[model samples]
Target: EADIYQTPRYLVIGTGKKITLECSQTMGHDKMYWYQQDPGMELHLIHYSYGVNSTEKGDLSSESTVSRIRTEHFPLTLESARPSHTSQYLCASTGLAQETQYFGPGTRLLVL
Candidate 1:
């Protein structure tokens, strides 16, 4: 199996609620990232971390926040979600940016 995993492959949430997207990896990768993607399109960086306790915001705007505690786990949380927050969340990791990043199947979220 792939090293990465994301739960709730699909989620339909109501407006103004809290949600957390789980991401974990078996591989001992120190780098982890969270990206937002629209259907049939490219991915946009939303959040990233180089190592433990080193988290940085991406160039894009997201209502979500991420935390990295263990080397193999990173989870994103949305304090209050809206319809505008609906998008596919892809979790990825790599030893380096130039190297290939392994991605999770993604969590497709829709808010109405």
Candidate 2:
């Protein structure tokens, strides 16, 4: 089993509604990342954190925000949901000395 976890594996929301997707890992990796992907499309990095109290926006422009206050927790929040936001959100983590990233089961979102 993967060490990472994502809550609410699927979500359906109306436009303009707010939502939050939770991600956590038991592996105690200091680096965590969030990626957004469409079916059959390449994944885009949306947010990332290096450690507690350090967070950064990723290469992609995302309406979602993420916070990292603990070593094993990284939660993403979308202030306003939209149909355009419908896609899969994936969470990943890597140890400081590791190059391989372990991914969690992605959360699929559908905004109506």
Against the true structure, whose lDDT is highest? 2
lDDT of 1 by residue, 1-112 (tens): 5689998799999998899999999888888999999989889999999999989999898878999988889999999989998899999998744587989999999999
TM-score against truth, every candidate: 0.94, 0.98
lDDT of 2 by residue, 1-112 (tens): 7789999899999999989999999998999999999999999999999999999999999999989989999999999999999999999999999999999999999999
Best by TM-score: 2
Query: How far off is residue 8 in model 2, in Å?
Result: 0.8
Poorest stretch of ten by lDDT in candidate 2: 63-72
Report the poorest 10 consecutive residues by lDDT, candidate 1: 93-102
Q: What lDDT does the true structure give each of the candidates? A: 0.91, 0.96
Deviating ranges (above 4 Å) for candidate 1: 96-98
